[model samples]
Target: MTDESLVRACQTGDREAFSALYDRYIKKIYTYVYYKTHHKETAEDLTAKTFIKALEHIDSCDPDQRFGAWLYRIARNTVIDHYRTARPALEIDDAWDIPDTSDIARDADARQRLAAVRAEVQALPSVQRDILMLRLWEGLSYQEIAQIVQKSEGHCKVIFSRAIRQLRAANALAAFLIILYATHSI
Candidate 1:
């Protein structure tokens, strides 16, 4: 069923519909939360909380809005609230327990680069990061992101543009550091 159909069913008190919604979004929501908190336990907890909060307030959700965007907005707000209350340290953990050391080593550099980018993105102001994640990571359309972030579409577009520029700048800085390290090594 389409998200909209599931939402309508949920509105009419279909428990199965809500479960379907949860199943559809839990991983993405967890990923979004994990990126922000950089801790497995907290991300897992917050992901559950996000769904709970969404269920509690499902009636308030607009039927016209895409349910995925709505769920993501809930997840984003839950993570922000968690950060406010917990003030958890954000550090990327590089340990992935894949059995093959060779495979792990092969991807280690790429994983480290992604972690650095994630850290840089997380360091952005919440508004910018939220919009960027919703647009780029979640693959929401401008209008959908605007709806989720409670901004005008034009404003969202501007914010997304600036956020990308900031990410590019951060990447350039990382490149410069790598070059400096290479020169020092030789």
Candidate 2:
């Protein structure tokens, strides 16, 4: 069923409809949260909180609004609140069990570059960074980003265009996945 149909069913108290909605959005929401926090456990917790809050307030949701937009707004606010409430309350273990020493030097260099690029992206203004995250990471369309960020589609396109230009100018082409596409060394 369409999200709208599911939403209407949910409004009418259909458990199955709510379940479908949760299934549809959970991964995307988790990915969005993970990219922000860079911690698996926190992302999972926030994703759960987002859906719980969504369920709590679903009745007040406007059926005319895009479901993804509404859900993401909740997620964004939740993240903001989490940051406000506490600062790194927990340390998540990210140790890898497998010892993949196939290319230790190359892997370390790649990780350093990735960290630098992430730092650059984070330095961008919130909207530009969000546009890049929603577009590049989540593979969300400009229209979807427009709704999620509450901006005009044209404005979102412009912001995305500028973000790419900025990244390229700053030699952060690693983020643009130019590993093999670049003709000259970046």
Candidate 3:
């Protein structure tokens, strides 16, 4: 079912509809949260809380608003709140989403490259990092990111561009591979 139809159904207490929405977004939401928390259990906990909160406030959702965008907004707020109450989050691990290789040298090289990229990306200003993550990792559109970040679509594009440029300027190879890994389009 379309997200609009599913959302309407969910708002009207259709548990099945809500489940569909949950299933559609679970992985993307988990990835975004996991990248932020860097702890599997904490990411899982936050992901559940985000969904529960969404169910509680489904009525307030605009049927026309992109459901993914709304869902991400909730997830973002949940992460922010957790950080406020919790200790400083550790930097995201380099191999957080990397698949292991049988070739030890290749695996070591990949991890080292990923670590270099991660350090630079993590060093970016928060807004830039968020823009990069949503655009690249989450595969969200500029419009969806703008909605979630409360920025204009044009501004979102500019931020993403600047982020890419910053990474490239730091180290071309790491930046290239990081961008490649982060994006499906490129």
Q: Using Cα atoms with residue i matched to residue i, what is each candidate's TM-score against the true structure?
A: 0.70, 0.78, 0.76
- In model 3, which residue pairs have backbone atoms overlapping below 3 Å? none
Taking all chains together, the TM-score of candidate 3 against the true structure is: 0.76
- Who wins the lDDT comparison? 3
Q: Candidate 1 — what's its lDDT?
A: 0.73
Instruction: Give a tens-digit lDDT track for model 2, residues 1-186.
Output: 988889899999999999999999999898887666555677788899999999999998888889999999898778767755653563321111112332212234434545657555654666787789898878899999999989999999999898888877787556466757667664
Higher TM-score: candidate 2 or 3? Answer: 2
RMSD of 1: 8.4
Off by over 4 Å in 3: 88-114, 172-186
Ten residues in a row with the worst lDDT in model 3?
97-106
Ranking by TM-score: 2, 3, 1
- Poorest stretch of ten by lDDT in candidate 2: 91-100
Choose the strongest candidate by TM-score.
2
Which digits, one per residue and each the tens of the lDDT, describe model 3 over residues 1-186? Answer: 899999999888899999999999999888888766655777788899999999999999998988888998898888777765543453323223223342212234434555656666656776787888788877878988999888999999998999888877887676567777886645
Query: For model 3, what is the error of residue 127's alpha carbon versus the real structure, in angstroms, after optimal superposition?
Result: 1.9
lDDT, each prediction: 0.73, 0.75, 0.77
